[model samples]
Target: MTSSRSETAYQRAVAAFKNPTLDLLHRRYAPFVVSVLSVMFTAERPTVPISDAHVEVGTFVEELRAAGYDLDERTLPNGTGRDICRSWARVGWLVPQITDGVELYRLSAQAVGALEVAGRAGGGRAKVSRSRVRTLLESVEQLTQSAETDPALRLARLRDERAALDAEIALIEAAGDELDPIDDDQLLEDTENVLHLSRELPADFVRVAESINAMQRDVIAELRRDERPAGEVLREYLHRGEHVMEATPEGRAFAGALKLIGDPEHIDHLTDQLQALLGKSFAHLMTPEQRGELRAIAKRVEQGVQEVLQAQRRASHVITTQVRTHDPIRDREVDELLRSVMSGLQAWVPDSRAGDRIDPLRSLPTAGVRHLRQTVSDPRPPTAPAPLRDPGEQAEFVDADTRAWGGPNYAELEAYLAGLEAESFDLAAAFAGIGDAETRRPADLLGLLEIAHRNGLVESAEVSVVEALRPDGTARRFAFGAVTARTLKVESHD
Candidate 1:
């Protein structure tokens, strides 16, 4: 019988598989049996070994066993081999040709195609031929027939077909360097719709669309810069439109300025010059309160600068004097002693008389010694004897007893006390003549007090004592006990 075109291909594929160089083994079963088995294998049959005819028989029996067929391999006339042959014939891997009581089996042509395709698919040294395609198509046809009632299977098949068509279209387009006109029209329509939507949208949406339009325009302009005949000027127009849509008044002004000042480096300098000119020309442009506030701030800054310079000068003088001085310790001792004595007198004297009597004589050693003996003796150590005096002397005295008992040790003590007396006398005279003497300004007294305090001649309290003297003639008393000479010196100065 003359073979159909597909049948011819199948025969050719089978012939290739049978070639010695290909090394594909098939059973020496009947041609019909072999062909049937081959077609089944090609149709996605489970994997199995293909040997000679008896080997195929063996494989058939095993498959029967796997499929729960209850035939006994050993009990058959030809053992499992004949049973496999029987099973193959039953399952149509083989077909039986019977005459009278005798039966013969032949391989099926479909089975031959199946075996050839299966061998090639499994890397079995056989190349796929035109016959394999026909076999695969035949198998697909059979599957479609079998799954006709399954919606999911039908959908999967349709999807696979659509994917294949899509891939084919893509390959054709790529090769021809031509896009589909339909897709191009669709894209143009999409672009127009997007623009329309952007125009009709809410403010925030319009802003986002404007930004996207700007980006698109920028991209197009950059592409155009490559000298390609593209929509460069159109893109710039689009960008301008986006800017107009999105810009605030300040943004517009800034944009105008940026256009005017094209050079970024000079822009800052230009801005500064403009600001200065504006400030000069528009001084009246500011409100009265605003101008007042500005002036106040300027005044405060000026005052602050003056204060800083003054403090610096004072500090420099202090440091220089400190460096030049022989004994800071001696000065401190004198100031403390003076302050101590003055504080004592301030405590004992009435407020009215306190300023007149105590204030005037505070820095005098005579006044200090008298005040100390009278007011500050209580807290002195018992071991410290009273300041001694001459037997006939009426004034408060500093003899052996007084020297021993007065706060610190004697030799050091008398020296500090004497220093205190001298400082106090000078300070008292200075204070008393403040208004009368050109050199004796209240500022001079304050400067002296500041120096005395800075030099550690007296505690800060003693300086406050002077301030409390208050040319108004009221005395201010503060607590002190066993005071140092530094405090006494401060009191004397006050």
Candidate 2:
């Protein structure tokens, strides 16, 4: 190769390494990240609620810390798991999405690729197996026969396959019940090979989905640019929307996968075949992981297909809606203004200090006004001198009205207590004996207690209940320590 070619290849390699997939694996804490992600996400479960992911990641970190792992500030992320996840999102390892109105963390295509490599490295499969070679040979042979232009060559290939099948049939018939079965070792190897191939499907699906999303974003951006007429732009975008699944290589693969697994019968056939395989005598030789992978093959394919379809639908919907409500002129104007502002900030950033402040334009400046009032009239009263009213001329308050709203009638309660026969009586009973609703008011209870204390009352631990009436005609029951008036006396009216 020429020096230019070598440099070009090296530059391309460097660019590839800079991608998130390789960058993640190259990080210092890559093992930690991979282990956490692998455990948190699996084939059956792709997304975790944002809060749950944060908590689980935090707990895992704590466990690592307890396990004596070197997770210092330099070795580990600087903040809590939430911050770490946000950082991962910024670096494109995790994609934040909203599903069912809940924010979730899903492995991005790049993250999935990293995980796939990590998982394969630890899978303990043979470096090269007969099953792997056979699969490649069969695939290439089929491709060759399918691509053959001459009908004679195609017929010859079909004849050869038929001859081989006839021989196998004859051998089986001759063996009768003694037909040879595949060895457990070979069976396990083949299953593992199949699993190895299946593992790439999820990452491929994610790539397609992400590609479609990216295409939508690009289309919208181009529309906003208004470089072309609206009709022309809409036509281009509409065509993309209709053939969204064919927009990218990954999307094209997704389209082919749809042909294979989109049909219910195909999925059912795959499931049946898997079940029959598991029922074989050699199946027991496979690990639980292998068995599980085999069982979920059909389900995983369906899920991946659905995910890609949903992504395509989402893209179409977004692109269509953007086209319908598109205002190229306004969008272009806004885009230009934003670019200008960003350019200004970029220019100003080098001269700005960390603590520099700018008063944000929260609202338009107030209109200029002249001759505004600076002071108001004084709020003080005009006069303050007033003599007290003569007591004789004041109208007397009615007793009933006074009893309803005023504080406890000490004099009334004292007279009522004097009317009681026993020098010592339960305060509750005395208060209850009063027939006047006003006198039996809740406030009157306090008055009775105060009057009892003044006239010498004995307190006991025994409980007491007093039902008092309010002026609003509602009754309230209060419970307190028992109070018994002793040597009750009336005050002088001096």
Candidate 3:
């Protein structure tokens, strides 16, 4: 009630606006955050994990920088869109949760709410239904009747609700299971309203978290100004922290909301209702962001409230800095040094132990690693590869017989062709002499010529009279049946 107390309370409330969360969302990263949230809406799930967004966020950051957005120098190369999202989580707009060992992000209830408000940003008026008024009117009536204190009024209101319920039940029974369906327009309007609420949740939480933080900061500032003893200041800090939670409007409402959000059954019911609404034909009335918010609403709210609680708890610290009061290592070393100096003073004089400073590190003796030479294999030595065995037994066939070994090999054909390499063609006797006629058969004669022809050694062949040495190894003239010539022309590949 005092002026000082009122000023302090006002300052705490103002701290909510001081938080950088709202600034980042609505100012610096507004376009990026909105784009991200909008993209997440395209997914069937509420969470937008980094796995699905590394490339997407990278590209977005690059494009934004190109468009002359004021991004940090380091962020341009590495793409800090993810870091920007993390900042939102730090401020309670997004819940940074680890599930399945992966850090995932979901829009907090506060973020959803902000999006709803911002949904109309840079755009035209929002589309609210005519039935939205009807829904709000009915909601106000229910809230007012539920809060009635007079016994007579409460009883009359309860009786009316029961009568309406009974009438609805009678109609359903009278219809023989053919219940009247809800009007499509009303359903569409309600669906849109639900979507709107889903959007508002995240934004609402942002306000709550910011307020809690502001109140926390105010508590610390007050304690810092307190001139009481250290113990008294700590106790006062604890007391003020507790009082704020109980007396502050933001604190009271946030505590209640956190409880409701954390309730498993409440979350399940909200999720189920949203899913059911989305499944309806009327779901098309909602925007992409609204649909995404509905899908992730339960999870975001649950985790986001927990994170907000953590931030508030951090603000409850007595001194807020451990380094200010003590240091275990430093104290022990100082105690030892004091004892040593005092003992020296008692034994001799203060001048004996006194010096500019004793460099503890300097007198500590040398430390070095010695490497001893040992017989170790040379790691960089060049080594030859193991000789590979041939593929072994390559396939061989001649087009004439379609059988293996039905042709002369390169060696046999090479020698036979070298003699005719100087001539176009010769009598068949020349080929006959190349082999032993006494042991050779007709197939041998045909196979030798086939091998030569296949290797591109033959150009043309004809039946002609020619003098030749017989295979019998005797000097005798014979009429050769066929003569062939080697191909004198070569084809160029290139």
Q: Which one is best on TM-score?
A: 2
- lDDT tens digits by residue: candidate 1, 91-140: 44544533234444443323333443453455334333334455568689
Give all candidate RMSDs, comma-separated.
46.0, 20.0, 24.4
Off by over 4 Å in 1: 1-285, 288-310, 339-494
Q: What are the per-residue Cα lDDT tens digits for candidate 2 across 1-494?
A: 45798899999999999887888899777887888999998768878999999999898888877787754654555568998889888877899988668999999999999999998888765568899999999999989988899999899889999999999899999999988787889988899889989988888899988987887888888877778776787687778766867767777888899888899899999999999999999899988988998998888898788777887787777778987999867887888989999998999899999999877889977878877999999998899969887674465766544437668978788788777777688888889899888788888999889888887888889999989998888989999999988646666787
lDDT (Cα) of model 1: 0.43
Candidate achieving the largest lDDT? 2
State which candidate, 1 or 2, has the greater lDDT: 2
Q: Which ten contiguous residues of candidate 3 have the minimum total lDDT? A: 400-409
- Model 3 global lDDT (CA atoms, 0 to 1): 0.60
Query: Which pairs of residues have clashing backbones in candidate 2?
Result: none
**Superposition error at 10 for model 1 (Å):** 99
**Measured by TM-score, how close is model 2 to the native structure?**
0.67
How far does residue 467 in candidate 1 sit from its true spot (Å)? 78
lDDT of each: 0.43, 0.85, 0.60
